[model samples]
Target: MKNVSRVFYITLALVIITVIFGAAFPAQFEGITGSIKSYVATTFGWYYLLLMSALVIVAVSISISPWGKIRLGKDGEKPEFSLPTWTAMLFSAGMGIGLVFYGAAEPLFHYLSDSPTAETGSGKAFKEGLVYAYYHWGIHVWAMYGVTALALAFFQFRKGEPGLISTTLKPLFGDKMNGPLGTLIDVLAVFATVFGVATSLGFGAVQINGGLSHLFDVEVGFTSQFFIITVVTLLFLVSAWTGLSKGIKYLSNTNLVLSVVLLVLVLIIGPTILILNMFTETFGMYIQNFIEISFRTAPLESDNRSWLDSWTIFYWAWWVSWAPFVGMFIARVSRGRTIRQFLTGVLTIPTLLVSIWFAVFGTTSGNIQNNGTELTQYATELVLFNMFDQLPLSLILSLLAIVLIGSFFITSADSATFVLGMQSTNGSLLPANRIKIVWGLAQSSVALILLYVGGLQAIQNTIIAAALPFSFVMILMVIALFKALNEEHKKMEAEEEKKQNS
Candidate 1:
């Protein structure tokens, strides 16, 4: 308790101080953050690609190997939540707001943007657009989450260790995880989780404000965004007070249903056949070109290299930043499941849903673009609402979309609070309510500060910068987890031998 409290307060003080500095000196902060982000991306672009690829390989290998049978908890334990509910929570916490925000915008951007290998506004460009969208949102990002979640679940559940990111590396470090090094690691995890989720919260607030403006004639600016953030933060804190099983679970379930309804409405009222065909063709292209797309840095082509850094590198960094929060939440909800089942669920389900979502929304937007409607002319944040305008019952669907985004905002914020509390409280499965509330407010404050500092782009640059060091942390975690798993396997084998001898 003493150690957890000390770490929690230290982390809280550091985060508050940083946010204050950023808010007070917005230009200086953005300059520093932006420089660091560019340096990391330009220098280590290949490293990010290689590391992400290795993570995917490791996750897949572990799932298919004999280790697949190893339960995250005890051998006889079953899953905590049913498949459907569990999947809902995973999607909600993982990338619910992102999918909604970018489903229409990303594909359209890719379609219109210049590409080195594909000509803009051509058939190849359209295919490449959806393909890249899948590449960004697909197995790689989930694998990053899966590896971290698997390590945490194994150490915390199976081995009876604390849920801190440092604790997962206890196999290699032994007691050092209890020392200053461990404190540093845990502090970094908290920082990463808070900023990562704050970035999402900032996005949610902007999009929600945009939705309101589109639907209700409300104004759109910092005032509207701040108001949305304030109100939604209170809602999430109250939801956090209700605890995970009731508050988060119910919201996640509702989010999934509403999301599905929106997707269905878009499909039915939009070009239904075109979306279906786009899904089939896009899925095929994504699978076929997955490897090339994953490793393409446009090394020889400077212009294409710039585009790669802006889009693909940024996405990888964003996902890595998010791994701690999403990974811990997934680990919390994924107790008593086998490695195979966990990987399958995390990697497959959400990727498929994202693909379908991008197909429907992306293709519909593309159709509008082709018809001279020029969907991309609107701001990226407003593109989703604009696409909604083209369909039947635009008003109702737009309102529902706002409700869905707000629900996702609350769920994501509350989940981060829970994860942050757990990380700060020595990985207690049920962290104290006071801690949850404190972190909840802190997360909202960071978002509010970032909004004032430089809005969405500033939030993104901060996330990419923060994610740099943690990417190395994730790599070390993979090594430690593999070592621990191997030791566990040997111990199990020795126990079996002893029983036979007896």
Candidate 2:
């Protein structure tokens, strides 16, 4: 009880201080966050790239190795959730809000801004834009989640360890895991999860506000967005109170249905053929240039390096920040499955859905741009709403989009609260409702404060800064997981030999 209290209050105090400082001195807060983000990106960009690449390789290798057949839990244990429910929850928690927020906007931004490496406003630029968008939302991001979740699941279920990020490193640290080092690791995990989820909540609020303004003429500003965040925070807190199966699972399944309906509507009403063609060509291009793009570091061109830092490096950090929250939630729902099944499902299904999402919304927006819509005229938050305005049944579809975003926001927050509770309560699978409520409120408060002070840029900078230390932790986690798995394999071999001799 004392340990739990210490973790909760210490994390709470740190978050409160940061939020208060940010709210009271907006300019100073922004300057500090911005400077930290810039320093991390400039000095550590190469490391971030290498880390992501290594994670991808590790994820794929683990899925194919003999260890892949090992169940996350005891041998012969079956999966807890059905395939569809599992996929829905993972997708909703992982990147549902981000996809809705950036699907059309990112592609359009790339199209308009043009790449430093690609020609401006030409056929090559179009391909480069889509490829870059795909790259940002591709397997690399899921690979981060995959590796982290795999570590947590293996340690928790197979080894009977607590379901905490620090616990996963027990093989490396042994008894020290019960000391300050372990507590600090868990604290950093909670910090990363809070800010990462808060960043998404901030984005969701901006987009929700933009949708309301487009439909009902409500002004889009800090006040309106703050109200949106408040309302969303309440909704998600209520959902978290209901616990995972009743609140989060149902909402996640609903999110998936609504998302498919929206996708089909856009495809049927928009240029169906063109969207399909673009998807095929862009997918091929993404595959053909996957390695080059993944490892590309613009060492020769300052402009290209800046662009990479802003887009690619920033995205890597964001995904790494999200790994702890998403990974733990995934591990909770992934008991009784083999490492192979978990990795395959986590890596493939979401990536495919994201690609299709980018194809439908991104290509449709680009087509609108080609027809002189000037998508860049609107704010980034308003791009999705504006894109929907051009489709048939604009008002109804826009309302549906808002609902989807709202649901995504709730589901993501609920999952984050659950994960934070587990981390704070020493890896309890079912954390107390009070813990959930506190974390839920803290996440929303951070989002609201950041939105009020520095808007989306502040949120972005915070995520990058918070994720930097956690990225190193994730690398260590991978090493620790490999060591544990090797021991397990050797023990199994020795047991088999003894049985045969007997």
Candidate 3:
């Protein structure tokens, strides 16, 4: 554990030094920026999509009868947390800032552009746009987190390894990968997690800035960004310090409630008929074209394909970027769960809910933009603030919306703080409170600096760059997990034969 802490501290020092030097001599680091951009654009293109797709398949398979029995928890130990609490924490942690940012924007964007998967002039094409949002938000995304979590939990808790991602590979590699190689993998996971989560924190800070601007009639500038970051940082740092059972769990619960309230308000105030119709049709379209869109790899020059790249490819990469943090958080919360329960509950349920959110929010926003006398031109004029005017309960809804967004950001930050602290600790599921607080503050500081560097795009691009290597790492993780499972089965068989002979 001390070794682990030392490794993390070294990495932390390097990252901080790099950031300070880059900020001081931005021109000198121009090549670094270009390199990060190229890596994100070229390498993370299709591999992320394929990795997510594969993870979903594995989770779905585990949800069925036979394979689920191989879940790696110990016998006679009951669950530490209830299903609802666990589910909410996992869902909120996984959804993070993306749901808040895209919930109202994606459906509207799709409706304006039409579904990328649908044939032209199909009156049904617009409906499929909403469905695409749902499809992207649904089960497949959560499955990625589910597999990563299950691997960590089963191997760490049951196998008694310190609960690290590298330890999860032990079933397959035996002792070979357990030395420096395993530590390297763990470090990679940490790198991906920090950069990816920092992206969300940066975005959350921007959204917080936007909301404060709207609510308080203040200008959008340094003061607003600074204020929001300070508040959010304090909130999440406190939660992280408080530990998961009390702090993270409570924050997640609040986030879910506030999210629902805002969604319900939108549904009630907006055109119910259009939202429902669009949701149903979009769901159908997504289901019908599931395989096609799921595996799409259209070249950069294809017509209407840019839309796919902008929407689908971008989302897949974003989710991949997010995998390490969400996966690690899920692993922490998912002890005592069978593979089947973990898959269905974590992957399937959250995906369905996310789809519904995109469906409802997207359809409502789209309908207003397309048909409403006030909204059509309104949407064109206002980008992030577009959702504000479309609602009948604009003022009340804005309050709820801001609350939900803030809570979502805080919940995710708190969870990440916990995971990063655990990662840097003795590989224990539960680490010391001070370490969690330190990580939380570190995250907040990065977010603040990124805000200074021109807001969310800078942070997100950096994260995408850092995630390039780990995208391949996740694939390796998938292979390692299955290989470990196979080896475990072989060991069981060998023991059974020996017992029979004795």
Candidate 4:
């Protein structure tokens, strides 16, 4: 296992280094990796959405099943957190900065552009947009995180296997993956997650830079980007080294508090009537057309193809790239959680919170865009900052917004750092401090390089591309999960029969 991990890392280092130097000269790397991303998206993007949907269905089923009832602890072991606290922590950590990014923008984007339902309509598209955003961002995505996390948590804490995907798959693969195959899964998951998360870091850095630049009227280019990365990295590294109890626990608590406050602030400032109305309409549309939207596969020639690809395909890949890290982190925290508890926490709670946030924030942001707001006149880069700047409480609210974004990014970065350490050190929850520091620094460096290269969009696309292969691995996970469910059921039945006979 060690040899395999070593070889994989060596190869990965070479590839990343090559990409870096290749990207150093702008013209060369763009034509290479950029073309690859476009080609893959053009070809298999629809299939990716289908796979994402399938994974969601599979995860939901597993979450409600009897096998899922099995706790991670040993026979006499007790749970860590009470139900509500555990649920909140799991949802917050699983979600992280994603809420901050998509919360306002995504729904508005969907509302402006057509979704699978109203591809050609421009009327009432804003409500359509919020619903569509909720659709994509809702339970399905987190269900993916929940299932992957459950697999790792159960295998490691319950079955005494290493807390990696390979161990999660051992029930199906048996010992075959215990050698090279298992190592391969871990390596792929690690690589995909690193690049994927680094992309989020890049986005967070850019957004942070934008927020600061808007407040101070400075340029939000390379220097500011690097500055944000350095500051955030130090913060996360400190949190990570402090371990889950002190650093992670405290940060998450802060994150939850600040997020709620931000939401409340938006609700107070925004037009409550418009925001609530849009929320209701969008939600209704989502329910009315839930199946169609979820299963929509308008072909290349179909009118809805472009819209679906932009919204759904992109999100599916984005989530896939993120699954490993989020999954591992969720599993780590869900040590003693029941399957139903895990599912509801991952699916329902975050979705409800995100929906409300979008209703308030996204609606207000979109309202500014719809009206002759000064913010919309600017480029997309400046738009978000300008929108917040124009708010009634611009100065105070903008500062709060900055804090919200920074804290969200910190929560995600710290969690990933912890999980990466665990993955690196053979699935030990309490990995060595040195290992934690190494991963933290590496994550920070990767974020910096990615920011320097093609900015946030390029980083996101590149990371999404890496996840193309692991999408298959996740499919295998879904299958393995069901098989484990069946096996556990059979074991229960046999035990029951033995008891009756005796």
Candidate 5:
């Protein structure tokens, strides 16, 4: 509370107001958010596609260019965290609970319920389904995250600037970034972060309830989920107040180990051979059709366009909305690596790992469906748990998955608390604990309200709508980063030439 910035007050006020309105008039809140989601998908589908593609290209270019050698910190400084630890943090911040929630259900849906292009329930749909899941959770999301994270890391560690998003624009905006415009930018970022984290929290609570209700005799409604969120909220708040290396690092490493164990067991138990084959085929298809799908809008085909609206457009917006929180958190954990190493690790490692996770789960689920089990008839949150039920050691696997979700839930919320606190107080490395607690409550309240209003759908609609403004901010961030990187590279060249002359 001592070092809190005005951004905190304004953002808090905005979020409180939103929660009040949502709580007071749940129907209107849901209706307005749904309209915004539809409008964004229909009106700016092309813009999202292009913006995401450019971000990926920009991230790739930075990794391969001469500027890649620029260290995120002052020259000669070593990274604060070890390689494995850093990677774990990156993996955790990147996509913890989501992979669990949508890991299998997405592909199963595409193959059975709504094929992207192929006839529903056809072989082509089965194959194409995995490819689209790979596309959505693939390099595009990480690239957008990498570039934004790179910008923040370069400016904060190397230039010794504050870690706020607006500070990255100094090369473009100069002193104006320290003014009202900058405050607006930071507030918007905090607002987006709130929703992004809240959505994940909502998903985590619901899915945890889904797992419990499936495994135990628990009920499957807001009452159970409400308690789940309450318990996890207190747990994560404790972890959040603990310093990063102590709390987050341990939880994330645990998440990685649990994730690997679950993946291996499912691969062996579900459909081992088919998982590998699906991986090989879809990896190739994803690469081959990557460019076409990157720019595809399908204006002539209403069916395809509608699919794009629901899946692709929504995904693009989700990633952009998530970019700030992911970017800032990754930047915090990625302080000492060079630009090249940073971007390479960010763009490649997570993308590959996520693709494999999806392949294993997606392939296994597809196999189950093809075998005559109508898994799609179940709720989305219960799909993965039910899939586990069909495998060996079903009870143990279900328990492990619940623990994994719980850990990921805590880790994600932990990261969010710190990011929110940092952004709120002008990027303070050690934001006051009270401020974090307030934010923790704020985030949890938002998630609970969303659950009350419209559950998972309300979460999705809110995110799609929240992402639109931040997408423009992301564009500005890329421009600012490029300008700064180019100017710095020129200075490096001039100094190198001067050294030769001397």
Candidate 6:
């Protein structure tokens, strides 16, 4: 409490007001959010697409440039975690819930419901569906995250700045970043972090509820999701109280194991050849069409534009909104790594791994539908469960999925609590347990409230609305990071020249 700044109180009050509004009048809340979401999507869809695509280019360019030699911390400081542990943590925190939630459903949606460039249910649509799935969750997503995390790590570690979003801009703003404007920036980051994470939590809860309904006939609705959020919130809150190194670290490792087990099982049991083929083919096509897809605004085609707004633009915003939390968390553990190493790992490894995941799940879902399972009849949340129901070891796979989602649910919420605590406090490496508890509950409550209002629709609306401001912040961060990196490189070069002259 003593370390808590006005950011904490301010963000807390804002979240409380949102909760009251959402609770007192759910219909009005959803309606307003929907209107704003629509406006942002229609007006700024091109901006989101361009900004996210450019981030990929910037992140990749920086990693291979001369400045890549610079370490995140003081010279020769060793990394806190090992390679395997680091990758696990990256993949877990970066794409954990999503890999389980949308891995199957996204492809199915694109193929059966609304293909990006092909007629629904056609062969071209099938291939393009998988390709676009790779597009949405591919290197671009990691690029946005990698750029954000790279900046935070560079500033917080090498420059000895606080691990807050606003602090990353001090290179551009100087002392001004410590003013009310800075508080506003941090608040926006915290606000985005809260809502963005809550969206994932909402997905996790719904999928868990869906799995429950499949396995045990548990009712699938708001009540089940509410209960799911409450129980999982308590689990993760306890984990948060245990501290990050032990709780989140170990849980991340556990998530990695479970995720691998589940992925491998799906590969083995559910259309192995199709998954392998799709993984090989789609990844290639994804690369080939990457440029066209990245810049595509669908300006001439209303249907394609509608699909873009619903999927691609939404993903761009969601990733941007989610970046503060994911970026900060990655930055914290990334101390002492070279900029090249951090960016390389963050951009490439997780992207490849998550692509493999999407391939397995997406292709398998497609195969099931092609085999006449009529999977489209299932709700999005239940698609994975029903898809598993038609596979070998159906019960075991379903149960493992439920457990995996639950594990991801806990780890994500736990990590969010830690990040929120640090953001609210003075970017403490180890924030107070009580502060974490407050954030833990607040996140779950927001997720619950949104789910109650309009299910996934409400969550998506809030994400696009919340992400618009932060996208501008991300642009400024990239500029500031480059200026600082260039300045430091020049300083280092001049010092070397002086030493040689002496």
Best candidate (score: lDDT): 6
RMSD of each: 1.4, 1.3, 3.1, 2.6, 1.0, 1.0
Go through the candidates in order and give each one's C-alpha lDDT: 0.89, 0.90, 0.70, 0.72, 0.90, 0.91
lDDT of 2 by residue, 142-178 (tens): 9989999999999999989888899988888997987
Q: 117-167 in candidate 1: lDDT tens per residue?
A: 678899888877888899899999999999999999999899998888999
Using all chains and alpha carbons, the TM-scores for the candidates as numbered come to 0.98, 0.98, 0.90, 0.92, 0.99, 0.99
Question: TM-score of model 3 relative to the true fold?
Answer: 0.90
* Arranged by lDDT, best first: 6, 5, 2, 1, 4, 3
Report the Cα lDDT for candidate 6: 0.91
Task: Please give the lDDT score at residue 146 for candidate 3.
Answer: 81
Model 2, CA-based lDDT = 0.90
Q: Where is model 5 poorest over a 10-residue stretch in terms of lDDT? A: 297-306
Superposition TM-score, candidate 2 onto the true structure: 0.98
Worst 10 residues of 2 by lDDT: 1-10
| Better-scoring candidate (lDDT), 4 or 6 | 6
Candidate 3 local lDDT, 331-363, one digit each (tens): 778777777777778866787778778877767
Positional deviation of 37 in candidate 2, in angstroms?
A: 0.9
Better of 3 and 4 by TM-score: 4
User: Candidate 5, clashing residue pairs?
Assistant: none
